[model samples]
Target chain A: EAGVAQSPRYKIIEKRQSVAFWCNPISGHATLYWYQQILGQGPKLLIQFQNNGVVDDSQLPKDRFSAERLKGVDSTLKIQPAKLEDSAVYLCASSLGPEAWETQYFGPGTRLLVL
Target chain B: AQSVSQHNHHVILSEAASLELGCNYSYGGTVNLFWYVQYPGQHLQLLLKYFSGDPLVKGIKGFEAEFIKSKFSFNLRKPSVQWSDTAEYFCAVFSNQGGKLIFGQGTELSVKP
Candidate 1:
């Protein structure tokens, strides 16, 4: 079984530019999540999806960030008008279900740098 | 809202030394706890987890964590550390109610030979 996969392991963009990252979860996983990890800090949950519907996105910056899990297999996270604060690693994870005890598998993550 | 805390930011020890990393969480309700490890340039991997039954949960690579519900703490420990055990250790929590896992700031461990 393959682990979660993320694209463009590293990215660089100027402030005000837009960037997007992609993720492919483990086979047969039903729950997917996006997280942001600033340097020297642990990951912060940005959004979560159970299949095609969003389960939680309270921490997501609605004004600048948006994400979608089309067809419920692969997902994309986008940030428009990127700011210097957006420089961080974006991680994608997936789990077998939404239950609290389910183990979440994570991807390698995309490291973004905003100039 | 839930928050996890890791007391140690960085630790260094000689190989074969005992190890302990403290983690505390703030959430009154029942929770599912986890300890994830990330080696250099690697993705997060589950070291161990605690759900309901046992307080002392053992994981791969000789890692173990004890979940003390009364104290709201889960600390990772190893009897004898190895150079290969150097990595970033993270503590996370999932509330029984719902949603995503809340993570700690992480502790970076370096083992010397």
Candidate 2:
């Protein structure tokens, strides 16, 4: 079985520029999540999706950050007008279900740097 | 608000040394705990989890963690560290009511051969 996949392993952009990261979850997984990991910090959940519907996105920066999981298979997280604070790694993970104890599989993550 | 905290930010040790990483959570409810490891250039992988029953949980690669409910702590331990065990470790807790997890600021372990 293939693992969760993410694109553009690394990216660099200037402040105020727009950037997007993509993710393709493991097949048959029902729950998907996006997390932001600043240097020397653990990943912070940005959004979560169950199938094609969003389950939670309370931490997402609505003013600039948006994400979509169309058709319940792939996802895209975008940040318009990126700021220096936005420089971090974006990780995508998938789980077999919504169970609290279910193990989540993660992708290699996209490292973004905003100048 | 639920939050997790790791006592150590970075640790350095020689091979064959014992290891212990501390984690504490602030949620006063039923919860599930997990330890995840991420080696350099690699994705995060589960090391072990504690859902219920036994307070002592054993994970892959000879790692173990003990859950102390009264102390609100879950600490990861390894009897003998290897160079290959060098990585970032994260402690995460999930509330029984919600499936989402709250993670601690990770600890980086570097084991020198």
Which portions of model 1 miss their true places by more than 4 Å? none
Across residues A7-97, which tens digit of lDDT does each residue of candidate 1 receive? 9999999999999999999999999999999999999999999999998999999999999999999999999989999999999999999
Q: What is candidate 2's DockQ?
A: 0.84
What's the lDDT for residue A99 in model 2?
88
Candidate 2 falls in which docking quality class? high
Q: Please provide, for model 2 over B10-43, each residue's C-alpha lDDT reduced to its tens digit, 9 standing for 90 to 100.
A: 9999999999999999998999999999999889
Query: How large a fraction of the reference contact set does each model reproduce?
Result: 0.84, 0.81
| Least accurate 10 contiguous residues by lDDT in model 2 chain B | B94-103
**Model 1: residue A59 alpha-carbon error in angstroms:** 0.7
lDDT of 2 by residue, A14-99 (tens): 99999999999999999999999999888999999999999999999999999999999999999998999999999999999878
State the displacement of the C-alpha of residue A72, model 2, in Å, after optimal TM-score superposition. 0.7
Q: Write the per-residue lDDT of candidate 1 for residues B1-113, one digit (tens) a residue.
A: 68999999999999999999999999989888999999998999999999889799999999999999889999999999999999999999988765568999999999999
Residue A81 accuracy (lDDT) in model 2: 85
Clashes of each: 0, 0
